[model samples]
Target: MKVSLITATYNSEATIEDCMLSVLNQTYPNIEYIIVDGGSNEKTLKYLNEAAEKHSNIILSSEPDQGIYDALNKGIAKATGEIVGFVHSDDFLADPSIISAIVEAFKAQEVDGVYGDLHYVALENTAKIIRNWVSEPFDHRLLRRGWMPAHPTLYVKRDLYKKYGVFDLNYRIAADYDFILRIFKQPNLKFHYLPKTIVKMRVGGASNKSLKNIIQKSKEDYRAIKTNHIGNWLTILLKNVSKLKQFKS
Candidate 1:
């Protein structure tokens, strides 16, 4: 199966090259790599241009976007593969065979989605491991407890986007959470959980960069709960706090 991997970037010159290299080096051969750049002024485009020349399967676009989700929508619109996934500018695949394993999982399970563990790494030192966030299998009851597979590790069928919908741009940091909840909460959709680390994400992402952003994320999480009709405000707040344990691991 062809897997489309999208990476949304903006001024990512500092770390995006490793992300690109990780994707390029994936053991999966039938992969489509697309980069949606948000009009970066730094060396971001320069690196992308170089990668575009080297990788025949790679596509590049540099333009202004509202935010990460807007860029993601563009990538999703352009994807031509059966299975779609994403790797952020500051993240990399956990292993060379991770994508290949994802394809095997899809072939074996015949499900709408597949996800696994995520390893949070120190930004200053890639060798330093900070936490291991092992996601639980899907459960309608867990949404009330703030349980979600690491967004970076989630991969779904391309058709699911057409069926359910894309990320709601209104959510600044919680749109991904909302999208996952929307898909998994539906009884008809089938999901598979792979017990392996799929992605290595760098620490200090926008959502958890500061206390102010954490407060804003809490507000957005509540909005996601309301918009998806998942639960009440108090339930959403508790779910957000439940994620704090991820840092301890």
Candidate 2:
């Protein structure tokens, strides 16, 4: 099956090239690499163009966007594969064979979605892994407890978006959490957990980079729990905090 890999970029020249290289060198060949750039002022677009030129499977668009979620929605609109996944411009697959592993998992299990673990690296040294987020199989009870898989490693079927719709524009940074809750926590969707590292992300991203953003993320996450009828507000708050320990491991 073909997998559509979408990346949302904005002045991400520092990490974009590595991200492109990871995908371009993938063992799985039937990939449609699509990039949605937010009209970067830096050299990000030039690198994006260079990568696209080298890989015929790459499709790119650079334009002004509302935010990351908006760019993701746009990428989703252009996706043509049966399975759709996103690899942020600042992130890369953990290895060249990641896509091959994902495809094998999907084909073997016939799952609607598949997700894995993530590693957050320090900006000064990409080789230095700062934190590890090891994900587990989906459990409905975990939703009320504010549990969510790493968004970068998550892959969903294109048809699921057609049925459930795209990311909620209301969320500024927590849209991905909301999207995962809506998809995996809801009824009747089959999800497979790949017990491996799928993506390596740089630290200092928009949502988790600062104390202020962390507070905002908590507030938005609480709102998501409320909107989705997950559980008691206080319990969800505690549940959200519990996720921080995942990084320590």
Candidate 3:
């Protein structure tokens, strides 16, 4: 199966090369890499220009976008593969075979989606792992407790995004959470847990960059839960509490 990986970048000259190379070097031959750059004046545009010369399937557009979510929507619109996934500018695939394994799982398990674990490494030292987000198989009840697989590890069908819709631009930092909730709540869709680290992301993402962002995230997360009718304030509490174990691990 062809997997379309969408990468949203802006001024990511320092990190986006690794992200792009990770996809370009994937063992899976059928990959449509779409890059949605947010009008970066830095070396980001230059890097993509050189990559475009070497990569025939690299569809790139550099323009100012509303935000990362909006940029992702643009990537989604351009994606033609059966499966859609993301490897953000500050992240890279775990290995060359990760995408191949994801496709194998999709075919063998007959699941609607595939996801694995995520490793958050120190931005200053990508080799030094700061946190591990190990995820389990899909269970609808888990959503009520605010449990969700790592966003970067997720790969869903393109049609599902069309059916359920893309990220709500209203959510500044919690759109991934809201999007996952919207998908998981459905009874029809199914997912397979690949049980391995699929993506390695750098630390200090926009959502958790500061205390103010954390507070904002908490509020947005609560709104997502309440708006989705998955649970109330208690769900947020459990969701926050669940992270303790991940840190401990």
For 1-249, candidate 2 gives per-residue lDDT tens digits of 999999999998888888888888899989999999999998999988887887789899999999999999999999999889998988889999999899889889998999999999978688888888898998888777767889999988899999888999999999998888888876789889999999999889888879999889888888887777787677567766676776644
Query: Residue 139 lDDT in model 1?
Result: 74
Each candidate's number of clashing pairs is 0, 0, 0
Candidates arranged by TM-score, highest first: 3, 1, 2
TM-score leader:
3
| TM-score of structure candidate 2 | 0.96
> Candidate 1 local accuracy as lDDT?
0.91
Estimate TM-scores for all models.
Answer: 0.97, 0.96, 0.98
Model 1 regions more than 4 Å off: none
- Give per-residue CA lDDT, model 1, range 1-249, as digits (tens): 999999999999999989998999998999999999999998999989988998899989999999999999999999999999999999999889999999999999989999999989999887777877888778788887777888999999999999999999989998999999899899998888999999989999989899999889889988888888887876866776666677744
Among these predictions, the greatest lDDT belongs to: 3
Q: What is the lDDT of residue 159 in candidate 3?
A: 92
Q: Which segments of candidate 2 are over 4 A away from where they belong?
A: none
Question: What alpha-carbon RMSD in Å does predicted model 1 have with respect to the real structure?
Answer: 1.2
Which residue pairs does candidate 2 place in steric collision? none
lDDT of 2 at 34: 91
Indicate whether candidate 1 or candidate 2 has the larger TM-score.
Answer: 1
Better of 1 and 2 by lDDT: 1
